[model samples]
Target: MSSIYLVLDMQNDLVHAGGPNGKSPLGEQVVARDVVNKTARAIAKARDAGVPVAFVRVGFSPDYRECPKGSAVFSGAPAAGIFKLGAWGTEIHPALGKREEDALITKHRVSPFYATDLEVLLRTLGVKRIYCSGVASQAVVQATVRDAHDRDFDVVVLEDCCAGPSAEEHRNSMQSIARFCRTESSEAMRFETLI
Candidate 1:
């Protein structure tokens, strides 16, 4: 099946050790999982296999106009002054070795497909399946996987290339997601087999 790999929310603030959210208790767990290197390797493998890649990030306007005040997940963002557009925190983590040819999508919500051009891009690219890897498996990864599945796209979760605030959360999310999508480590994906 024709496929694209999505590297989701591996932004500096969410993954890097020195970024805004990087020092948070949850960030510590993300950092400990070494998802950056794992995701980087998955990107490399996808590129080598000639699969298109898309980088998805979450960010808001400078005035925080797009941020919702009632959502607990993002309510603090405006006050915290993080994830603003053009800010270093919103940039993709440097460790991923992003390429100019890859597509970039900035989103305001958990699911990459929500209010984003991701669906259009996927359709434009004729993407039949998506390989997902990202930080906070229980959040963005889970949301995106279910949304993608609902959108009628075959979805695969690169489990090793994803992390969460805790091991249990990660494990539980993966277990639940298995009902909707296939879950595998980056090493097990074997791009050649898919082709």
Candidate 2:
């Protein structure tokens, strides 16, 4: 099958209402309350359809050594906290738990394709049609979709499965990305329809 569904950065650090921490400074400030539920449904649909599912997580090395010291995102991250490998925050959210065969890709940057084994894995699988879904749409979704386009993949972004810091940001990002990739609701992009 050429089609693969990539679920990006759906880790507990970013998703889940009562996740690792009672409240995420970032999530609380943005994202819809139903994001986790929405993405989970999409994942379930993909799995049920036998579509290849790839999970992407944003994490740092044990020492945060791999992280750029000056990056705004990591600049003030707690000296010792989640998002570190093996930590609860870095784990894939409970909603989209990983199975033995699911591909788990740990990304250092926003783009899952950047400096990661994603491309090689995709190539090996002969994936050509990519259904993208994830958080922080303006960043990960935008960059990854663009890169996927450049790499000559048929790309579609499932809007219902993606969440941003706010509805405005999510809407804006989806609107912008619609120019390059097919942006549709998760329901409309159901695996039954696509497969």
Candidate 1 runs further than 4 Å off = 192-195
- How does candidate 1 fare on TM-score? 0.95
lDDT of 2 by residue, 1-195 (tens): 678899888888777665643365447533444667777788888888878888999888778876767877665555646578888888888867678798999988778998999999998988888998887788899998989999998898988777777778878998887767998788776663233
TM-score of 2: 0.90
Model 1 global lDDT (CA atoms, 0 to 1): 0.87
Off by over 4 Å in 2: 20-33, 78-80, 192-195
User: Least lDDT summed over 10 consecutive residues: which range in candidate 1?
Assistant: 186-195
lDDT of each: 0.87, 0.79
Clashing pairs in 2: 30-165, 31-165
Q: Which candidate leads the pack in TM-score?
A: 1
Model 1 lDDT at residue 6: 91
